[model samples]
Target: MAWHDRAPDSFTATLWDGIGDVWAEIRAHPFLTGLKDGTLDHRAFVFYVIQDAHYLREYARALAVCGARANDVAGIRMFCEHAAGAIAVERELHESFFADFGLSEADVAATPMAPTNVAYTSYLLSAAYGGSYAEAVGAVLPCYWIYAEVGRELLAAGSPDSRYQRWIDTYGGEEFAEVVSQVLDAADAVGPSLSEADRAAAAHRFTTTSRYEWMFWEMGLRRETWPV
Candidate 1:
């Protein structure tokens, strides 16, 4: 089968398909359940948004690097468009978040970075800069896909007027969907170009990034030290 044809099901594509199942269970203490319900306090919400905004900056930077690495004008154009789109939508989303949190952009920009935040951003940057464009997409797609899926779910689970709804709406909207579609299409196209090892690597990178994404959210919800 083609590499793309061999990609995992939804369950398996999310990080080795349950390596962290035990940890996830343990981490799901009742307090952590608060996060599931989106009942985060103002401070936690602000912290999450601040850290998230910083991540978004790196997201664009990674996409740009990946575009250059692709060495194809069409690929580069897609990445550039994705980067511009991220800047427009994510920054505006962050601004809205800042307003919700009563924080200024400077305030969020100045906030301290957690280890998970740094590590996750670094992974994408490294992948984009040091690895091939296919690999870079592998690293970055999880963040976009996970947020879009989860955000859409969150919106469906409750009243549409909640503060959390706004957050979900921003990323779960059509603009973000377009980005996901673009990236996935890119992935499908690029998969055929990769060798077996590279294809496996891309798939692995994607799954790993997805797990980290879950942890990042869990950490933010837990309001604890950033989980690895």
Candidate 2:
């Protein structure tokens, strides 16, 4: 059966489709286009990537917990596997990025979280602890899905043959595809049955999350700084 078929109902499918649509739109946004094409400044964007990498393990662990709560053995396995992959990728990517740019983990960690950064992490943790596995997936899809789309667009837009290629390659590659597919499938399994009010609440959460994603790119370009 198709991975999506494992989803219990159409509600879950709709949620995943909605999340994917949001991500695709973000990819095509001009703001992100400029950022990825190197038309924008680098410090904030670089800081975002490195600091965000530090949180991947937390994100993955939360997903695993949610999956287990839902009795989703496959979900648990997928999150665990994906987390392992993130560990290796994060190590390699961060080290390379620091070496290439003459930065360090302290630089990124000491940089206070941008509003967008905090929003992204907050939404994930909130959804993971307070929502279902499907909800958690919905909350997290923006990052992975948006990066993949942005990676493709950046490449098409003639992103240089530089270290940025690693960022593009990591997100645009087969590995990320699998991670996204699994996340979407998990979202597809959780039917969105909240009442109209509940749906409105959920939609609000998602929209806010999407908006924060844009803010993240903006922060990158602005080189927004904050206290540690």
Candidate 3:
């Protein structure tokens, strides 16, 4: 029922292949490569997590919109459940990071969304709110897909830093992989039913968000801020 299950030149497959350049850049980025090797600065890691916490709030909302737009009970359940799961994981995992780093909730609350974070979340929310179901799926898929890809790869390298390992293990583990596989299946299931216009729109949404996926890492590395 998922892409990997029945996939042969599937929609998500094309989406994945189309982003080869971006995907390669993501692999090569120092922030990510450092994550695999465990040399990533703890400050940058914490900064990334705080920004991710902010991003997840809106992302969870977009996911709910995906549920709302879903044509079937299965899609509805998947998005809604993951919406809750996103928040739950954030609370458990991020809080552990904060505790280990001596950060209070106030510290996380005071940290602002970097400019790119704003732009990226804004794009996701816009697509979710304004687009068709296929478009919404496209908007949200990169986050699920890219993180799983990166996390699995990083887990293989097995970061020496226990903290990074927790992050990698969460994304790379069988459970998370199952979730991603389900989403990919959902994309394939819906692809044949969409109109040409909607399919094009979905492709555009997917490609754009794929770029933002890369920008997110740059944001962490640079601690991006508003220039003004």
Q: Number of the top candidate by TM-score?
A: 3
Off by over 4 Å in 1: 1-38, 159-161, 224-228
Tens-place lDDT per residue, model 3, 93-178, is 88899899999999999988999999999999999999888999999999998898888788888988889999999988888889
Q: Could you give candidate 2's per-residue lDDT for residues 1-228 as a string of tens digits?
A: 232243444553444456665665666665566556755446555665665665565566555555565546777787766667666766678778787788777775676666656666777788868874445665665655556556665655655546666777776676666667666655545544446555545555555566667776666666556655
lDDT of each: 0.68, 0.61, 0.89
Q: What value does the lDDT take at residue 5 in candidate 1? A: 24
Q: Encode model 1's per-residue lDDT on 68-171: one tens digit a residue.
A: 77657887898887788777867887788788768887787677778888888888898888776677888887777666665555556643336666776765
Clashes of 3: 0
**What is the TM-score of each predicted model, taking all chains together?**
0.80, 0.76, 0.96
Ordering by lDDT = 3, 1, 2
- lDDT of candidate model 2 versus the reference: 0.61
Cand. 2 TM to true fold: 0.76
User: Each candidate's root-mean-square deviation in Å?
Assistant: 4.7, 4.1, 1.5
Q: What TM-score number comes out for model 1?
A: 0.80
Model 2 stretches astray by more than 4 angstroms: 1-13, 16-25, 28-31, 55-58, 192-204, 226-228
